[model samples]
Target: MAAVVHRLAGPALLAHRDGIRAVYAAAFAEPPWHAEPAEADGYLTRLAGDVQRPGFAGAVALDGERVLGFATAWTSSTPLPGTRSYPRVTAALGAERAAAWLCGGTEVDELAVSPAAHGRGLGRTLLEAVTRDAPDARCWLLTSVRADATVRFYERLGWRQVTHPAPDGYGTAVFLGPGHPARAAAVLPSL
Candidate 1:
């Protein structure tokens, strides 16, 4: 069955928390994420609160009633809360650039596709559906460098890697969305 991507927000997204958790568990259990079921449960608990944030949005790729994949995003602000990576991203991009580029911009918090859904273009469809109407079309996301396929996937979709100051923990790699103002400035000058 061909999967169809649907944009979701507000109560609609909250209503699919179970489906989202199911997809996340199946997707992240693979090599890169290795997330436990408890972790998915914890994420759903956090997502319950995240939906209340301003500009929260999500997209799901569904084959009929079954979720094939999903993506979620929200607007970011200075001193981004809840994760050490935010500080590292700020430090890497600097206060001025980070503010100009990321603050108030959309941040892709999660994008996951079930292993069974791989190579079906559902990931790309969900990604575009979730961020298509982002503020100023600016969006960003972080992923582990170890996830070569994941990194390549984003890069293939025109995302630019920010190559300055290395992230401190977990080898996180940050990417600027296509057409972002900071993308051109964030590239390290060749020696």
Candidate 2:
């Protein structure tokens, strides 16, 4: 059965928070992220503010009433906002490339597929839906280098891993979307 991808924002997202949380918990509870239920609950509180940010957008993949996966993004500009590894990303990519390739571009803050939904294309669909209208299609995201399958999933979708060393304490690998200026000279190493 095909999962229906719905583009949601603002109030609609808030209303679906519980469904989103369920999917988030299921998706991140496995290897790599291993996020706890409490962490997933914390995300709901954060989501309240995230949806209010400039250009906030999200997509949820659903099979009937069950959430299969989701992706969220928002526009980020200079200074990169001081939250949740943004500073690490700026440090990893250098202030110059961060401002050039990421600042003012769509930042894919979260992309997760329930373990059962893996390989069903829901992750890719949600990612594309959330960033579909980004200016110049400039989109970027971060994932754990240890999550080999997740890294390959994004790479397979044409997201290029930026060559900069993963910043300490971040444990993340940054990726640049196709056509991103910074991607021109970056090496695509398998994580």
Candidate 3:
């Protein structure tokens, strides 16, 4: 069956809160330091409210009404704006730095496609949906060091690693948006 991707408004997200959380929990059985923490049932309900705010966006890839993959993003009001910050944003990015980094751009708060749906480009498709919808916004995300495959996947899509596993920050790697300044030397044609 063909996958149908739908952009979910805030209220709609609340309506499918459980499904959204499922994606996060499954994807982040052990996500990176900077990446948000896995969601609990309660967190799922909280997210429904958060994603409804201005500058927020989310999408779900469905195959005949079943969620196969999902993505969500949000706008920031600080210096280094991002979509949404989760897990422990302050600890992951350094308290002061976290707020600075998430001030304006559209952040890929969460992106997950089940293993069963891998290789079908759902991750990329969901990403494209947010980016396309927010042409004026910069995009970014935090991913784990262990997620080697996922890292390579983002790189192929024009994202650049801003943070590394080092003393100053969580072992997490921060990926900048498409064509971001840091990505100047890392551009590869999108597939």
Candidate 4:
């Protein structure tokens, strides 16, 4: 499919809003995610606001005018957000580690590729495009451990899993970028 991935500051992604939403709806409908189709609409709504956040960045993969995949990210807040998976992430990594590893660093919030577009490397391409400008490559993202393939994909890309969900805890794990400063010294559990 000769898809081209374009990294952008936000507006460009918004321009492909409907296409991006379709990709999200399709990609997350499978496996452990099983996100509702309506969730894609909500995501786009929240994304409109997310672009206003500090260090906001985005990327979209397009095969002609059709969106094959997309990725979004921004600087992690200093005080640490208390929403979505933030609380769980803090619980997993602890306040000190979370603040140091995530705060002010690029936080990869979403990476999605349509089911029909799988195996084309669009996910990795979008991920790299979005995080390309991460300061010192200090990037991080959280995903469900239940999604084995997703976890493996990040690991295969050299991202270091820096947190292991506590045995009676949530199923999320945080991963640091391959070249992130803390990744090298991270003594966290192995995948």
RMSD of each: 1.8, 1.9, 5.5, 1.6
TM-score of 1: 0.92
| Better candidate by lDDT, 3 or 4 | 4
User: TM-scores of all models?
Assistant: 0.92, 0.92, 0.75, 0.94
Best by the TM-score measure: 4
For model 1, the local distance difference test gives 0.82
The pairs that clash in candidate 2 are none
TM-score-sorted candidate list, best first: 4, 2, 1, 3
lDDT per prediction?
0.82, 0.84, 0.67, 0.88
lDDT of 1 by residue, 55-165 (tens): 888888889888888888888966566465877877777778778888888999899988888999998988898788777778998888878899899989999878443
lDDT tens digits, residue span 1-191, model 3 = 89988887777756666666666666665544232544446567667577766688878888986778888887755544332334345455565655544456677767888767889989999998766654344567777656788889998987776554422354466777774433454333344
Residue 88 shift from truth in candidate 1, angstroms = 1.3
lDDT of 4 by residue, 45-71 (tens): 999999999999999999999999999
Clashes of 2: 0
Model 4 shows how many backbone clashes?
0
Q: Considering lDDT, where higher is better, how would the candidates rank from best to worst?
A: 4, 2, 1, 3
